[model samples]
Target: MKISATILAAATLGSLFAAPALAQETLNFGIISTESSQNLKQEWVPFLAEMEKQTGFKIKAFFAPDYAGIIEGMRFNKVQVAWFGNKSAMEAVDRAEGEIFVQSVDAEGNPGYWSHLLVHKDSTLNSVQDVLKNAAELTFSNGDPNSTSGFLVPGYYVFAQNGVDDPKKIFKRVINANHETNAMAVANKQVDVSTNNSENLRLVQARQPEKFANIKVIWTSPLIPADPIVWRKDMPKDAKDKIKTFFLTYGVAAPGKSQDQVKKEVETLAGLQWAPFKPSSNDQLLPIRQLELFKNRNKIAGDANMSETDKKAKLAEIDAKLADLTKRMAALK
Candidate 1:
C-alpha cells in the first residue's frame, strides 16, 4: 500500500527542525552498488542533494565497489546509513548493529520483488525440474554468495531443497560473479543458465536491450522482500530521527512553494510522483528468514559422517521446523 507523507507533516515545521546541528554532521549514508558506481551516481545524486537540501544537513553518499566492500564499510562503522539486500542486510545488522529504517516500494507500490532463473532462448531447458536433472552438465552463474536474489534465496529455494549433499556433484560447474556479469555470461553463451533478480534484469535490459534478446526467464521464485535502508548504532539520535522523518514524509504535498519541490524529490527517489514511503518492519522479511533456516538445515545434513539414526532425526527436525517457518511466512502481511 502507498503512504502519503504530506498528511503527516501538517502538525508543525518546528518539530521537524528541532534537531541540533552537532548531531547532523555524524550521518554518513552508504549505498551498495547493485549497478555500477556511475549508474548509481546518475540515479542517486539528485536524490541525495534533495534530501540534504530538505534536512539542512550535508548527507554524503558513500559508494562501494561491490557487495563485500559495502559490508566492510558498515562493519567498521564508517557508514551510518546503508542500503542492503536481505541477506547482506542481515549480515550488517548482525555484525554492525545496523537497524533498518526504510524499504523501497515498486512502481506498482508492492513491497517486494522476485528471483528469476533465466536461460538462452534456443536452450532446451523448459522448467526448473528439467534444469535440476541436468544440473551437473550445465554451467551456472550465481551472483555473490551473500546476495539475496542472486545466490542465497535462489540456492535455498532450489538447491537446498535436495539437502545440499554437495549438489554441484551433479552440476558441471558453478561460477560466482556480480549480477551484471552473470547476465552477460548467459547472454554470451558462457553459461547455460544463471540466477538473477527480475528488477535488476529489467534495469540491465533497459541499458542494453540487444544483449538479452536471446535470453528468457525459465523460473521465478516467490516474492522476495525489497532491500532495506539501515542505520548504524553509533549514529547521533537527532540525526537518525531527521533521516527517518525525511524518508517517511519527503514526497507528500507540503504547503506553499515547497509542495512542487517535495513532489519532484519524491519522483526522483521513488519514481512515483508525490508518493510516501510506508512503515516497514523485519516481519516483511520472512522469505529471507526461511531461506536462512533452509541453509542451516542443509549444513547439518551435509555432515560427512553421521550415524543413521542421527541423520534421520536431523531430517525429521528440519521438516518440522520448516513446516512452522512456512506457516509463519504465510501469515506475514
Candidate 2:
C-alpha cells in the first residue's frame, strides 16, 4: 500500500512539472505586417512549416499592426522570435535583450533594399527638389513613425533639410499610414506623395499591378540593410541553436541540386531565401542609429538658444560620432 501510494504521488508531480515545458516549447513567432494579414500568412506558412519540421518545435504565428507591436512583444516576453527591420531590430536589442542571428538576402544576392519617396506618375512633381520646393502645398503620407524607410528616411532627408521637425505642419496635410495605405494613397492621388520600401513595392506589383504602374519613385535612399531574425538573449541555448541552424540551411539544397531544381524548390517558399546566415550583430544597426543621430543633429542645429561656440561644440561631437559610425558601416561592405 505504501509503495503504491508513493508511485502515485511521484507520477502526479512529474505530470505537473512536465506541463509547463510542453506548453512553453511552442515558439511565439512575431512578424510585422508588410502585407495583408492573409497574404502575410500565406507567405510564411510554407517557410515556417519547414522550420517546424526541421527544428522540432511548433511556431505559432503572431502578427502585429506595426513594428512597435513586435518590439513590445519581445520586451514583455510575449514573443520569443521575431522578424525585424534593422531599425526595429535595434530597438528590440536595446529594449528587449534581443540578439540578431540572421538576415535575408535578395535573389540578386544583395543583403539590402532601398527606401523610396513615391509620387503619382501623372503628377508634375518630377523630382525630390520639386516636392521640397513646394512642401507646404502638397498633401503627404508618411508611414508609421516607427518605420525606418517610411519615416526616418524621408524625415531626415526631405523634412529636416526643409527645417521642419513637424513634417505634418509643413505639408498642407499629412496622413500617418502603413506601407499598403501609403501606396494606395499615392496611386489613387489621395495624397500627393508618400513613403515606401522596395519590398512593399514588389508586393504592389504582384497584388495591385495597376497601382504599381501609377506610382513613380522620385528618390531612392541609400541601401538599407535587409531585415533580421531576432531572438531573446535569455532563451535556452538549444532553442537558439535550432533557430539558427534552420535558417542558415533553409533555402540552399545540400550541395547537389541542379540550378533548375533549386529554383523550382525555392519558388514553393515565397519568402526571401538566404541559406546559411552571415552571423549578424548589433553593428548591423549602426546606419539606423546614424539616421536617428542625424535627426538629433538637425534638431540641435536649429536651436536658437545655443551660442555659436556651443553649437560648434555640439555639431563637432555629432560629426565625430558619425565618423565612427561611417567607418563601422564602411567596414561591413
Candidate 3:
C-alpha cells in the first residue's frame, strides 16, 4: 500500500512539473543578417523584450550569418517567427511552411525603399553605365544571393536588362557581403562598387558617418517593398494572435498608453528603422514573384550557350508565369 501511494505521488509531481513546461512556450524569433548580428541585436533587444512582456511568450532572438540560414531555420521548425526581405520571404513561403502576417512601415513614412549601386566618392565611376563599361577593370562587391536589393533588384534592372546575364563574366572579381560590409568596403576602397539599400545607408549614416560620407550612390533601383514578418503557418492560433497584436500596437498610440510610454515605443521603433507593423498577407509577394520571373526571362534570352530551341521553350515558360502574375496583380488592384 505504501509503494502504491509513492507511485501516485511521483506521477502527480511529474504532471505538475510538465504542466508549466507545456503552458509557457518559448518562441525563437529569427532576424536575417542584413548587418552584423551585434548591430541587429542592439536595435532588436528592447523591442523583443516588449514582445515578451506583452505576449507572455519567452522570446529569443535568432541571427544567422546569411539570409538562407534563417530560411532553413524556419523550414526545420527551429524558428517560430522571422523578419525577411521580399526575396528571402518568397523563398521561405515557397520552401518553408512560412506565412506573412505583417510588414514593417518606414519611419519616414515612405511606402518603400530604393536599392543603390555604390562607389567611393573619389572613384571615377559616375553611373551604372560607367561601371558596366569598365567592369573588367574593377572588382565588384555584390550582395548575398538571397538579398532582394543586393542581388535580385540589381540583377534584373541593371545586369539582365543590359544583356549581361552573369556578373562574374564581366567583372574582374565578384565578392558577396551584407549591405553594411559592402558599403564600408566601397567607402574604404576595398571594392570599386557594391550594392546597398536606402534603409541600410541611413544606418551607416548614423553609425559611421565618415564611411557614409565617402560612399556615393551611382545608381538606384526602383522602389522595393518593405520587409515582411513571417511565422510558421503551424504556429498556434493563440500565439499568433498575441504576436500580431503585439506588433500592430507596439508603437501606435493606444488608449491605455501614457504619452511617455508611446514616445518610448516610437523611439524604440525608430532605432529599428521602422514606424509600426501593418497587417500583410502573401499577396505582398506578388510583385517580387513577377520581378523574379522577369529576371529569369531576361537571363534565358541572354544566355549564349543555350540552344535556340531550349531558350525559346524556357522563355515561354517564364512568360506564362509572368502573365499569370500580372493578371493576379490586376485582380488585386
Candidate 4:
C-alpha cells in the first residue's frame, strides 16, 4: 500500500513538470506584412516549410498587419523569429532584445540594396531637390512612415535640403502607402512622384514588365542595409542555432531549368538571391539610429501645421531621448 501511494504521487509530479517543458518545444516564426499578406503566404511559406524539413522542427509563421505590430510581437515574446527592414530592425534591437540572424544577399552575393525615387517616364520631376523646390503644386507618394527606404531616407533627403518640418506643406498632398502601392500609383499616374527600394522595383519589372516600363527612377539614395532576419534573444540557444543553420543552407541546392520557372515566380527583386543567412549585429543599425534622431526632431516635430512653440517643445523632448538611446546603443558595441 505504501509503495502504491508513493508511485502515484511520483507520476502526478512528473506529469505536472512535463507540461511546461512540452509547451516550450513548440516553435513560433514571424514575418512582417511589408508586402501583401497574400504574397507572404504564397511565396515565403514554402521557404519556411523547407526550413522546417531541414531543422526537423514544426515551424509555424505568424504574420503581422504591419511592421510595428511584428516588432511589438517580438518584444512581448509572442513570436520567436522575424524579418525586419533596416529601420524596424533597429527598433526591434532596441525594444525587444532582438538580434539579427541573417540578411538577404544580392544575386551577386553582396549584402546591399538602394532607395529609389520613382516617377512616371514622361513626368518632368527631375530630382528629390526639384520636387521640394516646387512642393505644393506637385503630388507625392511616400511609403508608410515606418518604412526604411520608402520613408526614412526619402523624408530625410527632402527635409534636410528644405530646412523645414513638413514637406507636405510644400506638396499638394503626401500620400502614405506600401512600396508596391506607391509604385503602382506612380505608374497609374495617380501621383506625380514616389519612393521605393531598388529591390522592390526590380521585382516589379520582372513580374510586370509592361507596368514597370512606364515608370523610371529619377534619383537613388545611398545603399540601405539588406533586410535582416532576426531572432529573439530569449529564444532557446538550441532553437536559435537550428534556425540560423537552416537559413544559411537554404539556397545551396542548385535549381535545374524547371526550377528557374519557379524562381521567376518566387523572387520579384532583381539582385536578391537566397544565400545562407548570417546573424546580424545591432552595429549595422547605427546609421538608421542617427536617421531616427534626425526624423523625430525635425520631421515629426517640425510639421508645419504644428505651432512653433509646440514643435520646439517636442523637439527638445525627442532630442533628450535620442541622446540617451544613442549612448546606450553605442554601449552595446
Candidate 5:
C-alpha cells in the first residue's frame, strides 16, 4: 500500500507539471475578414498547417465578421497572433498590446500594393472626377472602417483631399463591405462604385474571371506598405521566437528542401498573394499614421459644426503631429 501511494503521488505531480505544456501547444491565429471566412480559410489552411508542422503548435484559424472582432480577440488574449493591414495594425498596437514582428512581401516582387476605386465595366464613371461630380446620383460601397487600402488610403487620397468630409453625406447612398463583396457588388451593379485593393482584385480575377471581366478600375491610390503579422506583446518569448523564425523562413529556398517541396511552398504563398516574409516592426505604420492625421485635419477643416476657436486648436494639434511624423519619416530615409 505504501509503494502504491508513492507511485500515485508521483503520477499526480507529473500530470500537474504537464498541464502547462499541453496548454502552450495550442495557438489561435486570427485572420481579419478580407473576404468570406470560407475563402480565407481555403488560402490559409495549408500555410497554417505548415506552420503547425514547423512549430509543433496546434494552429487554429480564428475568423471574425469584421476587423474589430480580431482586434478585440487579441485584446482579451484569445488570439495570440494575427495578419493585419497597416491601419488595423495601428489599432491593434495602440489598443490591444500587439507588436508587429513581420511583414508579407508581394509574390510578384513589388515593394507594395495600391488601393483602387472600382466601377462596373458598363458604368459611365471612368474617373475619380466623374464619380465625385456625380456623387449625388450614385451609391458608393466603401470598405470595412478598419481597412487600410480599402478605407484609410482612399479616405485620404480620394474624399478627404477633395474636401468631402463624409462620402455617406455626399453620395446618394453609402454602404460598407469587405473587398470581395465590394468587387462583386460593382460587377453586379448593386452599387455604382466601390473601393478595393490591387491584391484582392487580382484574387477576384483568378477566382472569378467572369466577375473580374465586369469590373473596371476608376482610380488607384499611391503605393501602400504590405501587410504585417502581429503577435500579442505578452506572448512567451520562446513561442514568439519560433513564430518569427517560421515566418521569416517559410517559402524561401532552403538548402535541404527538394525542388518539389520548394515549388509547393512557393505556390502556397502565391495563393495568399504573398512571397516569403520579411522582418518588420511597428515603424511600418508611420505612413498610415500620417494618412490618418491628414484625414483628421481635413475633417476638422471642414467641420462647420465646431466653433472657429475649437477648430483652429484641433488643426494646430494635428499639424504638430504631422510635422513630427514628417521629421521621423525623413530620419528613416
Candidate 6:
C-alpha cells in the first residue's frame, strides 16, 4: 500500500521516538566509589540482579572515581539514578536538579552515621584541639570535599568552629582521599591526621582488621544524615516510581525467596543498604547547605583581594546571617 509522503515521514519519526517509550532498555546507575571500584561492582551483583528482575531493565553502573564525578555525571544527565553521600547528594540536588527519594539506614536500622577525625593509635594527639594546635606541624587528609562525614561534618563541626583560617592551609600539607584511603592513611601514619566515618571504618575493619584497629577515632561528630539515593528530577515518573518501589521493597520476600534469604543479601552490604528505609526530600540537606554557606562566608572574610574595610563589613554581615540560621536550627527542636 502506498502512503502519502507526509504520513510516511510522520510514521518514521514516531517509531524512532516511540522505540524507547515502548521498551525500557537500560538504567544507568551511578555509584561513587568510596572503596575500591572492583569491590563495589562485585558487591552490587546481587542487588543489581534483583533490581533488573523487578524493573525489567538492563542495569549498567557508572562507577565514578570520586564523589564529584557522579555529581557532575548526574548534572549532565549521563547518570539517571545514583547512590550519593549526603553532601554529594546535596551537590547533585543543587547543581543537577536531582531529588532524594530514599536514605540508607545502619545495621541497627537507624538512618545516621558518625563523622570521625582519626589519628594513629600511638599518636600523642588526643582530640580535635590537639590537631588544631599542631596544625602547622602535621600533615592532613580531608575526605572528598563533597563527602558528608569526610568533609561536611568535620569541616563544620571540627575545623570551622575552631576558627582555623583554612584547614587545608593550617596543616603542613593537605591531601584528599576517600574514606577507605583516609583510614588506611591514619593506620600507616602516612598522614598525621585525617577525616573518616564510623561506617567506613567498620568497612575497613571487615576487610583489614589490623589496619582498622590501628586507627583510632579521636573526635566524633553528632549523628549526620545518611547517604541518600537520588535520581535526576527530569526522569520519567513511571521509572522513578518503579525505582522507588525496588528500594522500598528490597530484601522483602518474593515468590521463591525466603525472608531470611533476602535479609542475608542486604546484610552483605551493611554500610550501603537500608532494608527498612523511608522516602526523603531535598529538605533533608538543609543543614548541609547551611554549612556550605558558612564555609563560603568564611572564605570571603579571608579574601586577600578585598580591602580591609570591605572584608570587615562582609564578615559582620555574614556573622549576623549565620547567627540567625543557628538560632533557627536550634529552634527546630
| Winning model by lDDT | 5
Candidate 4 lDDT at 37 equals 72
For residues 1-333, what per-residue lDDT tens digits would candidate 6 score against the true structure? 111111112224224223355334566688886877876776666677767777776667777778888887777766778888888998899898799999877766666888999999999999988988898999999888888888888888887776765787788999999888888889999999999887777678888999987988899898888878898786666777778987876766667778887777667555354455567877678677778778767677667899998988888887887787778778766
TM per model?
0.82, 0.84, 0.92, 0.77, 0.92, 0.85
Task: List model 1 lDDT by residue over 298-331, tens digit each.
Answer: 8777776888789889889878878987898778
Instruction: Give the per-residue Cα lDDT of candidate 1 at 113.
Output: 80
Candidate 5 Cα errors over 4 Å, as ranges: 1-24
Q: What is the C-alpha lDDT profile of model 3 across 227-258, one tens digit per residue?
A: 99999886656667878998999888888888
Clashes of 1: 3
Clashes of 5: 0
**Which regions of candidate 2 are displaced past 4 Å?**
1-24, 255-265, 268-277, 305-320, 326-333
The TM-score of candidate 4 is: 0.77
Q: 1-333 in candidate 5: lDDT tens per residue?
A: 000011112223234224346434667788999999889989999999998887877778888899998898887766778999899999999999899999999888887899999999999999988999999999999999999999999999999999887899899999999999999999999999999999999999999999999999989899999999999887766778778988987887777768888788899999999998999999899999999999999898888899999999999999999999999989888
The model with the greater TM-score, 1 or 5, is 5
Cα distance off (Å), candidate 6, residue 111:
2.5
Clashing pairs in 1: 136-170, 136-171, 136-172
Colliding residue pairs in candidate 3: none
Ranking by lDDT: 5, 3, 6, 2, 1, 4
Ten contiguous residues minimizing lDDT sum, candidate 1: 1-10
The per-prediction tally of clashing pairs is 3, 1, 0, 9, 0, 0
Give a tens-digit lDDT track for model 4, residues 149-262.
888887776565457556676779888877778888889999988888877787688778988999989888877878888887765566666677767655444344256634
Off by over 4 Å in 1: 1-26, 165-167, 255-259, 270-275, 302-304, 307-333
Of candidates 4 and 3, the better by lDDT: 3
Better of 2 and 3 by lDDT: 3
What is the lDDT for 195 in model 6? 91
C-alpha lDDT of residue 294 in model 6:
85
